[model samples]
Target: MSHHIVEVKDLHYTYPDGTAALGGVGFRITHGESVALIGANGAGKSTLLLHLNGCLIPEAGTVRMGDFPLTKKTLPHVRQTVGMVFQDPDDQLFMPTVYDDVAFGPLNLGLPPDEIEDRVMEALATVGAAHLRNRPPYRLSGGEKRAVAIASVLSMGPSILIMDEPSSNLDPKARRQLIHLLKSFEHTMIIATHDLDMVLDVCGRTMILKGGHIAADGPTEEILQNEPLLHACSLEKPLRLQGCPVCNPVRA
Candidate 1:
């Protein structure tokens, strides 16, 4: 009996200009499971991530973090519980310095100064960015900022972490480092990415979103192997699988 830390039901959202972002999308993430959210552009992956932390309220349907509903009254709590790391590290690391960025959440919680300092240092240490605490966000490298952004979320001590395109702008070494860092966390994680290889390495389950709806959801291995499903979503097999005869037996 696994505990579902995050649950979404019949979620629907539309942009102000008339774009239907999420159409009745629903899913549940159990405690400590890493789930990969895969879809093509305009498939509503980012919109759905917004709903997880109550950033975008649905026109219809419901999103719940544990038992707390994502209403106006509970939004702050939901945001705290479901930490979000945006696709661009720059979007999240806007504070003057790394220390302030990481301490922001804890400060909001009104924790004592000593506790905030402890949490900030622990988070930076966790992401191996303690050395950059005094540096401005603009001074850090892309990988360094990514690490700090993650630490900012981690400093809040959230139970679930949801990232949008976390591996988007990293070098090979940085990408590998990010993957290793994510793998070390014990919290439940949902990563929205096109990095099929990262999905294979970091997540056990995969969910495919197509036109604001869930087209497929299952084990990462099985879903990635379904060529038709991948084709429908405008996705391709992982590089490691694309060349492996065992993984891609029917090459045409």
Candidate 2:
């Protein structure tokens, strides 16, 4: 099976404190598609993402990675197919060295030492962190840490990449570099983020979640341009799309 297709059918979930996180969400993402999931806080974006890799089980529905349903029995394979980069780089980078962090996943898979080394190096190279592989992860800058965290996931050889708030806390240059790197990747990507500008640059399709359900899904340009919808969803047009006050001043 290709493992690049992701499908969710009538998924529902709730938190232990009686918060209804996802009422019933469904979506299908085909191979090689870069999709953005955007919503206000408590909209269930994270909840849905957690279900994709079996980190959170559905209370009343199904998640499928390619042809296989995501259950405890298939959790291992699903995790291998779907690589997740958490919101905070610190949450992902726990090993002493960058190389160790990147190698951790492959090591768990019980791959040979040489193969693990190769994967670690290749992943670090892919994220432009090969030069920092010997350094301690905590010593790296925010952008460098982000890169290495991504390298750690890449080493696992996942076909579907799920990233949460990737550009958060990044300076302009680092954010730009991240956009370029994301653009260069061929993996099927699902990014849940508040950065609409990054969404404009990195994703072709956008899905908006509201109150534990999907509110809208369409072309990024179209969805982002809908001021009414964006306002309703507690979002605004990407700064790039908004008219500059200096250029479009109001007249009496």
Candidate 3:
């Protein structure tokens, strides 16, 4: 039997303006599993991500992190357990300085000043953004900003991490750095991204969402290699799978 660390049961959500964002969606993420959330624009990936940490409560259905169900009373602890990274780093990094931004989460937890400092430094180092710590957040490069944003959450020490479009604006080098940094995490990770290559690198499982429902869920390799299924869902084969001289010598 699998030990699920996160569970969403019969989940349903509708935006305030009467847009149905989720319709009876459900899934279980086993402990230490790295899962990919794949879908097209407006497919509700971000909405599902918010539900993971109680950032946006489900209109109907339950979100469970471990033994605890997400509710008003458990939100604080739930947020501590799940740290979210938004699509844009700017949405998360608002402090004037990178050091301050990275320190914010631990500071809010009322951790000792010394511990917060250590965590901040450690997280910066983990993302390879230590040298950029003293600089102002707004002045940093896109990659630097992303690293610091990730560091901010890392400092909080969450065991369940969710990211939305993590590689969206990143250049190749920046994306590589982020992938390496994410690979070092021991957390149960759920990444919502269009970057299929990153999904291949970091996730063992894949879930494809469409029309507010889970359309497919299974082993990552099998799902990703299904070119017809991908095209049906408005996705394409990963670049590596397309016209690879060695692996897929003949493009199907």
Candidate 4:
């Protein structure tokens, strides 16, 4: 049996302005699996991720990381275990240089200076940004900044990675490179994106969020192939890979 790394039960959240973001959303993510969270705008994908890392505490229900539930006492451990990369790399990368940005997490965790340096180098190398370590984040291109942001999360050695719209603003080449990089990671991943093509390429499982609720959850190809269901959720079905047997195989 698969051991779940993240278990969310009856999770609910609302904004400070009284807008309900998640309405009893529930899901389980197994270790080493890459899952896609698909939804239209305002469907609560980002809100759901915030709860996973304790950035936004729920008004009700519970979010568990391993056996520890997300509470004030457990939030620190949960945040270390689950790393989130937001939609905008600029928002996540605020340090002076790429190296400092990547080293920030380990430093906060109180790692030795030498160990933090080692981790920073390894993470930058993993993301193919080793040479940009000394460069300031404000000077890097969109793709380079995104790569550095990913390196920052990876430096912490988290077991699970949660990304929100990773490919939102990248060009075709950059998006392809990002996808390849993500595919190489062994950790469990939950990617929130509207790019069905990305979901098809990088994830085996897909979950659809509609009106702050889980409307569909299953194999990636199966969920993407369901045109009527996608339509009802206000999501667009992929045009190119729709019926291609090689690309859209039956769910096992």
Please, what is the whole-model Cα lDDT of each candidate in the order they appear? 0.91, 0.94, 0.89, 0.90
Residue-wise C-alpha lDDT for candidate 4, range 140-236, written one tens digit per residue: 9999989999999999998889999999889899999999999999989999998889889999999999989999999998989898999999987
**Evaluated with lDDT, which candidate comes out highest?**
2
Which residue pairs does candidate 1 place in steric collision?
none
RMSD of each: 2.4, 1.6, 2.4, 4.3
**What TM-score does model 3 achieve against the real structure?**
0.94
- Model 1, 1-252: lDDT tens digits are 232387889998999999988889988888888999999999999999988887788789988886688899998878788889998888899899999999999999999999999999999999999999999999999999999999999999988899999998899999999999999998899999999999999999999999999999999999999988899889998987787677567646
Candidate 1 stretches with Cα past 4 Å from truth are: 1-4, 244-252
Q: For model 4, where is the 10-residue window of minimal lDDT?
A: 239-248
Return the clash pairs for model 4, or none.
Answer: none
Q: Candidates ranked by lDDT, best first?
A: 2, 1, 4, 3
Off by over 4 Å in 2: 250-252
- RMSD (CA, Å), candidate 4 to true, equals 4.3
Q: Rank the candidates by TM-score, best first.
A: 2, 1, 3, 4
Top candidate (TM-score): 2
lDDT of 2: 0.94
Tens digits of per-residue lDDT, candidate 3, 86-149, equal 8888889988889999999998999999999999999999889899988988898898888888
